[model samples]
Target: MRIRAATLKLGETFIGIQLAKIVESKNPKYPVGQYVTAHFGWRSHTISDGSPINGQIPALVPNFGGLPLSLALGVLGRPELVRRDRNRCWWSVGSHVGQIAKIKGCKVIGITGSDEKGRVLVEELGFDHFINYKIADVDKALTELAPEGVDCFFDN
Candidate 1:
């Protein structure tokens, strides 16, 4: 099928995608020249929608607004290339995961590297609790905060 391929443009190490041209008479379901997330490559370009990579796994291009395009290539795109739970947390990934989890009605307990980040996680993102791993004893905090035990612990 005609699809965009991420090719290392000559002399450049980065990749770009090749998007299928939109049939003019009807606007393609995925319009051309309009930015949308695709698990295309480390470089920038478009591709034609292709066969499912894995039947069990759906295509991932979680929407974000005003985010730099490169964030898609490096952070968002990397997960599709690997076998990792999308819910894992890191300094940056935690922020996104927390937001998504909250939307999914999951109570989030953010364990961040610093107290300031912890505060932000709770106040700004609506996390149920925050554990500053650098300052607070994680086990004690977690026990007090989530006495019921953790259903999911995402570590990034």
Candidate 2:
């Protein structure tokens, strides 16, 4: 099999492959030319029988609507599934998570170490509100920002 390394594990000579060509496959799930993302490790090629490792199976890359396939490595893949439950109040929003939450119709309140980053979270990232953990009491900020308490908390 041919692979394009995507993620690396410590001390491993090979890393996860984001783009791969199936030189051969006995499993119907994996066919030649079907691009897949899997933690196969840092190698130009590897062979597998389509077995799951630690319950983690290689997932097929879905259509990206003309978006880059690399986006599957992060934002467009798991994050889309992460935000499926809408109408929740979210806390400590990271940039990508916050944006995805908002797109999924969740109310987002970001927490940052600096006021500048907090401002960016609100102004640039479109978070509904931000708390500078350095300057404000987190407990107090949480109470004020989410009067009914947060429904979700995302730690970057």
Candidate 3:
């Protein structure tokens, strides 16, 4: 059995993602030189046996038609891909659509269930603003956050 070498002390885990290049491979599904994204944490290197954990293995970074790989680490990176590949069933439609909006120089405001989620949506995902629907009135919050009407609204 393979052992995961911890970067930090045992019994603690970092919840994170990485863009990894396959330097060597025996698996036909993931060839060498291909790029993959996974919740491989903060390791400099990792070994994946191509087994499913929570029904997920490493997912290939999509070919963005020559766009830089660094974009894969940002708003274009994790959300929709992981939502689909890992069977995570995340509410990704709005996030991905917001990503597109941000790319095109539009403002984005994500409405989520918790403040922590809203924080990540705004701070990490390039959203201009976010509202926690669980505690705030969405319509009122939207009015407060953006006195002018928003250009678009997305729901799933």
The numbered model that scores best in lDDT is 3
The worst-scoring run of ten residues by lDDT in candidate 3 lies at 81-90
- Per-residue lDDT tens digits for candidate 1, residues 13-92, read 33233222233313354443344443343444333454442232213343458653433433322323322222224466
- CA-lDDT, candidates in order: 0.53, 0.63, 0.65
Q: Which model, 1 or 2, shows the larger lDDT?
A: 2
TM-score result, candidate 2: 0.46
lDDT of 1 at 23: 33
TM-score of each: 0.46, 0.46, 0.42
Q: Residue 97 deviation, candidate 2, in Å?
A: 0.6
* Local accuracy of candidate 3 as per-residue lDDT tens digits, 1-156: 013444546766554566789998989999999898777765668788778634568888888797556556643333232111111112665677677778977777777777787777777788888777667877787788778865344444
Model 3 has how many clashing residue pairs? 0
Better-scoring candidate (TM-score), 1 or 3: 1
